[model samples]
Target: MPAKKAANQPRKSMKIKKGDTVKVIAGTDKGAQGKVISVLREQQRVIVEGVNRVKKHTKVVDAGGRSGKSGGIITTEAPIHVSNVMLVEGDGVTRVGFRRDEVTKRRSDGSTYTAHRSVRVSRSTGEEI
Candidate 1:
């Protein structure tokens, strides 16, 4: 038997999504802003462009007998906790809020319908994020 999907499911990770611009609120990268490149749900971390860089030492290896090279320092992106970041709005930093927009009915022939859509917006600016 397989697990069943429920009518309503709670997300385990942060609400931030890729392509969203975020500012680091705490840590060494505080005040730094960048676009979200990826999200690590299990670790509760996020990778932002040009943020949380760490040097990694690696040795070059040969697969088929080419050669084994010397080790060197390589800079790479490190994971940062999602709680240290905040979504930036037009005016300032703010949390994400959901709002539902009531759809207006439009009749082409003789049909009537209503649709409701939810959208995320910035609490500070009250604008769509």
Candidate 2:
């Protein structure tokens, strides 16, 4: 029963990582692509550069604690749903798939080993990414 329960656990997290290139698949940013700048695991959101821009009101800093300093509006990138983005391939234009590599068998005296490898494949050209 324990073994079956362990297998039913939800996935660890999303496969996407920081600095990874991703393409927007949904929303107003559809077809837009950019490098992943940040990931919000708690909210399941990602902020891609130049993807979602929003205005922020922030207090302006004074150089010498002067009262003349004034606050102004600032524009910045906002977090977007992670589901809208897809991992981009090496070519920088297509999405890719991840696959585990097959392990090789080895025997010496009394030993067994297994190796795991993952690679991305371009969905457009059917080539390794």
Candidate 3:
């Protein structure tokens, strides 16, 4: 059987998007800022450009017919929990908010319809992000 949906269930989404500048507020990398590379929605974690780096050691594999990649210790950015980072607005970081804007949209038959679109806004300055 399929699972039932909650009537009052809120929208599930991450405010910080790719290319957004964010600052680490907690953990060992606190105060470090970088662009958002990816968001792991299921894990509720985000991979920043230069934050939470980890080193991985791998074994080298050789292929006789084709070129193979050399294995060594490589450093890579790791995902950080969403709660540990804050979105950067200007010189400081601000909480994110959502607002609904009335928009005019067209349909497949060339009919126009009015709809409310949700947009992310900066809570501090009340400006769109």
Candidate 4:
């Protein structure tokens, strides 16, 4: 018999966004750092460039008689659990925090209004990420 894996925590807004550099903290690709290619919000997974590479054997597809697609073993990145990675700030990884700031917004009526927007911040340096 095999043991069951622990269930992931409830999904929340991910601090890491596409194009952000992150370092893998756990799993097979641990210690690897790369730019985030995509973020899977529902699944709580993130695909990082050059990390979690997997090979897929795809079959060729043909549509009608004019165009067709070539298929073969293709190497690509796979999604890694968000918890396994940390946001890279400056020369090291930093935990993400959120700060709400008041900002002036303009409406269609040409009136200005003050609004509070949430911004991601670096916990270590207390600076926006």
lDDT of 1 at 76: 87
lDDT of 4 by residue, 33-100 (tens): 99999999988899999999999999887655656677889999999999999999889999999999
Ranking by lDDT: 4, 3, 1, 2
Which clashing pairs does model 1 show?
A: none
Question: In model 4, where is the ten-residue run with the lowest total lDDT?
Answer: 61-70
Looking at model 1, report the run of 10 residues with the lowest lDDT sum: 61-70
Model 3 segments more than 4 A misplaced: 1-11, 65-69
lDDT of 3 by residue, 5-97 (tens): 787877579888888999999999999999999999767899999899999998887755667767889999999999999999889999999
Candidate 2 lDDT by residue in tens digits, 1-129: 454445555754655778988998899889898889999886789999889889999888774665767679988889998888888776456655677887866788667688878876667777765
Cα deviation at 30, candidate 2, in Å, is 1.7
Best by TM-score: 3
Pairs with backbone N, CA or C atoms under 3 Å apart (clashes), candidate 3:
none
How far out, in Å, is residue 112 in model 3? Answer: 1.3
List per-prediction Cα lDDT, in the order shown.
0.85, 0.80, 0.92, 0.93
Q: Is candidate 1 or candidate 2 better by TM-score?
A: 1
Quote the lDDT for 8 in model 1.
75
For model 3, how big is the CA root-mean-square deviation?
4.4
